[model samples]
Target: MPALIVPTTRLHTAWLEAHDEWGPGSHEDGFGLRPSDEVDSPAGFAAWVARLGRESGQATIEAHRVHCTYRWIVEGDQVLGGIALRHGFNDFVQAAGHVGYGIRPSARRRGLATWALGRILDEARKHGMDQVLIVCAADNIASAKTIERHGGVPEGIRDTHLGPARRYWIKIGRTAT
Candidate 1:
């Protein structure tokens, strides 16, 4: 329950451990919900972290930017999950969201996803997002509950790159207490 969000570099070792634990292609079930690829490799992951640190500007499909990826850390050490806060309409409304996350399998059911998302929402508000969109697989009850617990209202369902996904939105101006 300590700070759930941290710099990806702060938990690089833990990120690698969680990736190993979840195995390849595990991160795909969340976010864009696609299999791990070259960008998911250890070195690629490090570069991604560096990009987040740069915060130079918004990213484009052809160009990348920093601050797009955020990691959820547990106990200020272990990485339980992460989300890529992509900018622009395509990312905001489709591929990614104001946030997306996944708890490591071994760490599931401990409310980490809930806590992680709550933290992410706060970040969204800080970024001036009035409402944040979060989408999860329709069958992912755990993720649905986590979203609901964080004040996400069922906005609708949509077919995404990963198949049927439930879309939820949370008003960032309000914090769950």
Candidate 2:
């Protein structure tokens, strides 16, 4: 079974395997990986994990980022994917949504995204969020279904800096069956 755990340096090798599978890009949405992040080395990866921890409790205005929690989807020693739960709303949150996730190509079709989203929703509720927005690429049918399965209500599609995406709103207090 897969579980969501806070990012840690111990998973460095496993995380790199999953990251390699995504090929070369910053598209691993939930990892909160920035272009400046030097995750190739142990020290760099540890620093990145530390930065994520620091961002979890409050917004880092100097970095132009919001408060958010990052969790790795792991099954035993293997890293599968990641999910992010934003604590509050902002222009970026409005466009990107409160949650974002991505499962590695090798791990797709295993319902990992749905499971991770559900877990992250619980985190959002703990953070006192009554509702959360989630957006997926407009063409991503699989992702849409995952959101819908969690009681996500359609909020239409809109163009983002990344491109057009379909948005959904999930009421956090509602049963996320």
Candidate 3:
């Protein structure tokens, strides 16, 4: 099984491959580096890693108005996907929800996102969070179903600046199936 480990310098070497796998219009939401980030070379990617997460084995990153922790879903040496857990909910988070996640384009429809969220929910339990809010686009049935499979209850839809989105809440510490 893959594990949700904090983003680390050890995986910076995999950045280029992962970045290329995203393709056009893929979800770059939880990716620590932005489309504009300097990742031309290994050294540049390593430097980008410093500001995003898991520096020296811990997530000390502070961005997007929350104490955010960026984690990579990996199996052995391969970077499969990523998930973001925000410690605090801001106005933007209130509508977008607490958890944001994505699987690489090449690895989609393989049950990775659901599995990633399961592991992320375990991490959430450690933070003493009782429930986790997950948001997905109304048109994104795959994401919505993944959320539902994890016991996420629909909390209705909202028209946000990000467009129409569906919100859900999953109770933490719920036994994993």
Find the candidate with the highest TM-score and give its number. Answer: 2
lDDT of 3 by residue, 32-124 (tens): 556566876767777677666556333433445566677888888788888888766676568667788888778789899989888778878
Model 3 ranges off by over 4 Å: 56-63, 173-177
Candidate with the greatest lDDT versus the true structure: 2
lDDT of 1 by residue, 1-177 (tens): 645443455466776687789775455333223233334566876565554442442233333222354445566577666555654355445545556677778878887777767766666666666787788888899889988987889978888777888988887784354
| Candidate 2 global TM-score | 0.92
Worst 10 residues of 1 by lDDT: 57-66
Writing each residue's lDDT as its tens digit, candidate 2 over 1-177 gives 998888888899999999999998548988888889899899999888888884442234236467778888999999999888876788888888998899999999998998899889988887778899999999999999999999999999999888999999999774444
Clash list (residue pairs), candidate 2: none
Estimate the overall C-alpha local distance difference test score of candidate 3.
0.77
RMSD (CA, angstroms), candidate 1: 4.3
Q: Flag regions of model 1 displaced more than 4 Å.
A: 8-10, 28-45, 54-69, 174-177
Question: Regarding TM-score, does 1 or 2 come out ahead?
Answer: 2
Model 3 residue pairs with clashes: none
Report how far off residue 88 is in candidate 2 (Å).
Answer: 0.9
